[model samples]
Target: MDGYQVYRDAMTKDQWQGWWVTWPLSTRVRLGHVYDRKSDGVRRAGDLAARGIPFQREHGTPDGTFIYDSNESVDVAFKASGKTPAALSALTEADAGASVTFTRGRTAFVVFREYSQSGISDVRGLSHALVSAWWNKEWDDSLLAVTSVVAAAGATVLTAAEGGAVAELKVSASAGVGELGMADLALGASVVRHSALGAQWTGTDVTPFYQVIRLRKNWLGKIVAEYGPRPPGRGALPSALPPLLSEEIGDDPEAALEPGDRTEELPFHDPENE
Candidate 1:
């Protein structure tokens, strides 16, 4: 699992592109990155709305702990299930149809159409620098997937596998002491496992991940969720961007359908579907 090997165990070659979203029991963060007690509740949301950016929203519990699923994919189990295309949603290698379903502890909230610039490619190939960081951080069990670097001149694009895996981060010399750069980050946030519905399913938190996913490149540049009204406490997540990137994600201004604010009966990958 250290060196370059077939990604067969991680994803389906037939469907090289696809993602899923799920919400797990809220994470308990000690030294948090995204969520903290000091931030405004509706600030991020309001900004997105004001900017006219499209996003998905859902209702939460009494404490305002509404769960949100960002850009997600399921390339592994789909192939194993031998399922064909139906209403495949989310982003895919072929088209823009989405699958809907629910799981234990959480329900399908909604899925908004993803918006991103074109010309971006998925990153392929492997490097020891990436693996060593993850393994040393005790994160060898997770899937390792790579994506193409978009717009970034000097960086590499690496995304986690469908089930999700933890990987290392690389930093540049110009990176500051506590900068978001790889070396400064050293060991970043934990990479938790996701359920079929995209919930954080891994029993405990895995090693900190080092990938950097830009907001311009992501569904949202910044994420704000109401875990529990009482400052649910911020938790760790994957890095903000991939390793060694050097540019911003361009705005494509492409017109697409809205994914909507709720999920449907997702075709859970099963033997029958296969």
Candidate 2:
């Protein structure tokens, strides 16, 4: 850890330094694109996004909705499962600041970074949001976000208690959930730079898989607000909650749903947290 250093992908114009020299105090920060998984760098900071999770991974930002490769110089291949011409057109042909959303079985995954029509970039603090838009293609070349909308019918998109983990949401092969979970989901969004009018970014990212765990209930409300709307109440949500980053404890979210010790509701039912 002695000689540890970090860098960023310079904006398309500035080339004074190869991310080696430090910039001024007010200089904006951009998350480094570490292409090496085993290189002891950032988490999920490379190419070939992790796969085999319950939910799907789609490309394109929450806006534009068109899938594109952000890997200007990486080896990752993030895949975009389903796409419609509408989603793609919104990104390529639509106006900047225009936004769309990608939903996985009623759950909101990633919102796209706002951009101008010319792709001039309004990436002030929108990095991870951009990753949510990756369609497992090569740098902005192979991937394209399709603007197709698949209905979520016949699939098992259920929710259990309020403000807690998604106890159960099973999808039968005979009854597919209309392209649900088809996009790679990401978390830990931080505005890397407010350097420009529209340019923002989130440097860190990880492909989260579904796991049965207790949710803090509204823990993510404020964060979600920064991007868009949130679940109306803690009782139930259209989309199941994402897995927690770690095992945590707090009042049982279900207690408020009913009117008892509610402690019976529990930190978690699966015995793992028992």
Candidate 3:
């Protein structure tokens, strides 16, 4: 049997914008990156936390020889839904600790929100320098999607039509070595295939993903209960400041709500109704 296209076979045009990335799993570092194992653990955890990458913390041995601790992998998947407006709105409204649900073809797919470590990092380090220098020149001024060789494609690749492609991350330098002088440094990670919750998903560990999400269930039709403090509601939206010229002494602070403000119930009903 041939492979079936998930989106193209199942969804419509307006559903194109419903893509989401999963939380980043704190990467396993070699001895070079670990100054102090415990301290490094804290820092790495903080890094994932700060970026809101949802990750599973593990503390066990896969083979009973080596005990693995820290974020081993990220649960990355695409969210499909017919509730396009509701899903899109939830992306802006949901917090890292919350999960948003969307419907597609009478089935509901929910994605839990979290932070993602997807862009350049300011910290000065070997890995950061490698990623920054690579992205600065290679990915600048271009749309990029990087996946493993099995799912690589050119500029025309579409998730809906293809339903099976990796986001690309192309990097090349004239001199293989940069200031760090590691002449042949390369990065490698795993990408996995998942078929569940009425969707077929393929994901790599970390490939410059922006949004962090968690699926509400595993392949066995079980709800994966996530643990964390419920994040506070996206608070009162901020009012825009006056323009440069209007910043003069007498300029009134404009009280108009921007287009993205969440409409809330008025605290007080009309006096006439009362």
RMSD of 3: 25.3
Across 1-274, the per-residue lDDT of candidate 2 in tens digits comes to 0101111222111421212211111121122221211222112223223321122323332322212222222112122223322332322221111122211112211222222111112222112222222212122212211111211111111111111211111112221223333121112222211111112222222111111111122443433454354334323433323233111111232321111111121111111112
Give lDDT tens digits, candidate 3, residues 1-274: 1122332222212331232221121222211111111211212212322322222332221211111101221122222222122332232221111111222122222111111222222212222222222222321111111111011110111121122222211112321123311111111211122222233222222221121111111310211122222222234332222233123212321111011111210111112213
Q: TM-score ranking from best to worst?
A: 3, 1, 2
Candidate lDDT scores, in order, read: 0.21, 0.21, 0.20
TM-scores of the candidates are 0.16, 0.14, 0.16
Give candidate 2's whole-model lDDT: 0.21
Residues 62-81 of candidate 1 have per-residue lDDT tens digits of 21111122223322222101
Better of 2 and 3 by lDDT: 2
Off-target runs (Cα >4 Å) in candidate 1 are 1-18, 24-114, 117-127, 134-138, 143-274
Candidate 2's C-alpha runs over 4 A off are: 1-9, 14-72, 77-274
What are the C-alpha RMSDs, in order, of all predicted structures?
Answer: 24.8, 25.3, 25.3
Worst 10 residues of 1 by lDDT: 29-38
Cα error, candidate 1, residue 18 (Å): 4.5
lDDT score, residue 238, model 2? 31
